[model samples]
Target: MLRFEGKVALVTAGAQGIGEAVARRIAAEGGSVVVTDLQEDRIKALAAELGDALAVRLDVTVRDEVDAAVAAAVERFGRLDVLVNNAGGCIVSTVPEDTSDSEWHRQLDLTLVGAARCIQASLPHLVQTRGNVVTISSVNGLAAFGNLEYAAAKAGQIAMTQNFAARYGGMGVRFNVVAPGTINTPNWDNQPDTLEKFKALYPLGRVGRPEDIAAAVAFLASDDASWITGHTLPVEGGVLTGPGLLDLTPTGPFRKDY
Candidate 1:
């Protein structure tokens, strides 16, 4: 249970959703956590909720903010052992033609480049403690998502993880990625059809829970995964195994769509 005992972790966008879940998991497993978010109020609230963890206001897209967040973590915890780059999201619709250049940049900033920036800011401290990095990318990173910009950005994060793992393994800083599929988060509140649609493709017959991804992240951050690096683990409930791109074919009476 105390897999992360004595470890200090920083989870970006940790105020809510997947990020929040990750922070809580780390704390539960005996790690001291620093929860960072752009929403100062929520960050403070979550920090209070996490008891011993620190709450930091950070906009991952801003280099200074990223640096400050990492500094705060190291300052409070005395050392940094894990960095969870979980703050990125699709800020706009994936309709490529309609997505403006700014939107594209924003998507990449929040999802891909944001992780890179956080990594850069934390690398020094990570190297000092032989820490690990767990980036929350998307299954779209490997497959095609019409949300071309988001997909591209997530893909970039995966590439960054692989390269960082290769370069930093020597420094005792390992890097790995966890790609979740159709997670049931606040973001999905806007998509009424997402659950029904996702269940059809997800072999597990349900949308993923934040805790599911969090468990995988904690393992990768723990010594159990010390030998694992440059790996992209899809916590997708078997969705990645088959042609999940298309919905299941309806049978007999269920063929209403047909």
Candidate 2:
């Protein structure tokens, strides 16, 4: 459980949702965490709650801020053992036809390029510690789901992971990704019924939680997954395997209590 007892991790957008979950999980496992987000108050509050955590204001889209945040993490922790690129989301445009050029660029810059910047900034320390990177991508990147621009950016993260793994694996740094499906986060506050709608799609009979993704991320970042790199772990409750066909059957496949 204390896989990161002596490690230090830097997480982006760690104020809420999956990012916060990841920071909490890492810290729970004894890692010193640097939590960063645009919301300074929330991140500072989270840092206070996390005891050994440090809060840094970061806007991933800004190169200067990204560099400064990385420097601050090293200055505070001496070394960065993990970098969780969790600061990303889709814009209002859900479909390719409706997505404007600016929207496309913005999505790619924030979700894809922002991650690249952090990786670049943290690689030196990761290489020094022989650490790893766990990027939070989405299932939309692997399948033809909605949110075209966001999906494209997420897919880019996967490609970057593979390339970085190949390029840096020999140097002791690893790169991997976790693709989550229909997570029930604050983003769905406007659609209270969304969880019910997504439940029928997953074989597990429910959508995902932030903790679900956090668990996978912790595993990938831990030494337990030291040999695993350039891989995409789909912590999607079997939604990517296929639809919940058995749920539609009259007897529920085995007819057990159906």
Candidate 3:
């Protein structure tokens, strides 16, 4: 189970939720973690709790912060073995009809471009260590869910991951994407009933948990998936099956009908 015995990983948005789960999982597997999040106190506490971890205050949307986080990872851990792009979330407020260009840019900037920045900063260190990247995308990227701009950016993440895999595979590095379905995280705290309602849409009879995603990410980032790259693994609870009337469209529950 110590798949990351001698490895090191940098996880963005590692304060809580899925990012926290990923950090905990990697640490549990004996990996050194560079836990970066906007919440300084939270990440610092998490780093202390993980024993062999470093906490960094990183705003993925900021290039300087991203670069500094990568540099800090190499400085502390001596090398960077994995980069987990887990900083993105749905931030759009306007409906598709009135969504502004600025909002679109903001969404793409955070979700898509932010990940690219981390990859760019980590590539050199990863090249030396033959490491890899695992981006946390969403099922909306692969299907017709809602969150128009978010979905588009997530889809762009997948496209970029594939391209990077192709471009870097020969250099002893790999790239992959993990598209998750509805997971019970703090992001759903505002709408407690939403997860309950969405559970029926899944064939597994329950929504996903952060641990579910952590398991998938651990596999993809570990040596177990050394031959796997340019791949998008959906960690949904069978929601993608679309059983019966469970159609995820603009009018579906998956959509934020703002």
Candidate 4:
């Protein structure tokens, strides 16, 4: 049951949502987890709940904070076995005509650059331990979405996965991406329309839960996925397979429009 027994894991943005779920899963699987997040109170509380975890305040975009967090992980756990770069999230943007330079840059910073910083901070430790990295990318990266900056950032993240895999696979380190589709996180609560749209588009008729992405993360971080690297695994419930009918047209009572 303890697939990651005796491993040392550092998860970025481990305070809530998919990141939190991944951290809990790692702990449950017998790994010593360092839950790093910018939200001190949330991570502190989470660390308390997950008795085997250590909480650290880390702003992945900040180099000093990134270094300190990594150092803390190594200091507390002796060695780092895995680095889960699960920190990035949606950075809202506007249409091409309205999009500002700062907004675009901010999206790239939060989604792509943040992941890059985490990887940079953890690379040496990962190389030392011959560990693995599981980055939480998005299906939006693989396909076109209206959110230009967010999609571009995610695509950059996926590219980074491949580059890292090629660069470090010989060093006994592995890198991979888990691209989830329309995950129902706290952000979904703020935008009810997104949830409805995702369910409409998804063949499974429901949006993804945090654990769905967490499960993929756990597998990728474990030795069980030893042969997998540089791969973008779509944990998207077949969203990439084909388009689902938004409305089947008069086939059901709920079918009101075309």
Among residues 3 or more apart in sequence or in different chains, the pairs in candidate 3 whose N, CA or C atoms overlap within 3 Å are none
Model 3's TM-score against the true structure: 0.97
Report the number of the highest-lDDT candidate.
3
Write candidate 3's Cα lDDT for 1-258 as tens digits: 899999999999999999999999999999999999999999999999999999999999999999999999888889999999999988897778999989999999999999999999999999999999999999989988788899999999999999999999999999999999888888788887887888778888888999999999999999999999999999988778858225656777767531
Candidate 1 deviant stretches above 4 angstroms: 247-258
Q: Give the TM-score of each candidate.
A: 0.92, 0.93, 0.97, 0.92
Q: How many pairs in model 3 have backbone atoms within 3 A of each other, for residues 3 or more apart or on separate chains, i.e. clashes?
A: 0
* Clashing pairs in model 2, backbone N/Cα/C closer than 3 A: none
After the best TM-score superposition of candidate 3, give how far the Cα of residue 161 lies from its true spot, in angstroms. Answer: 0.4
Of 3 and 4, the candidate ranking higher by lDDT: 3
* lDDT tens readout by residue for model 1, 225-256: 99999999999888778556554343311122
After superposition, the stretches of candidate 3 with alpha carbons farther than 4 Å from their true spots are: 244-246
- Candidate 4 Cα deviation (angstroms), residue 241: 1.7
Which lDDT values do the candidates have, in the order given?
A: 0.86, 0.89, 0.92, 0.84
Q: List model 4 lDDT by residue over 1-258, tens digit each.
A: 799888999999988889999999988998889999989999999999888889999888788898899999999889999989888766664555687888888888888888888888888888988998889988778865446567788899999999999999999999999998777777667777646755766778888999999999999999899999999999987767746533323332112210
lDDT of 4: 0.84
Candidate 2 wrongly placed segments (more than 4 Å): 244-258
Model 4, position 107, has a per-residue lDDT of 84
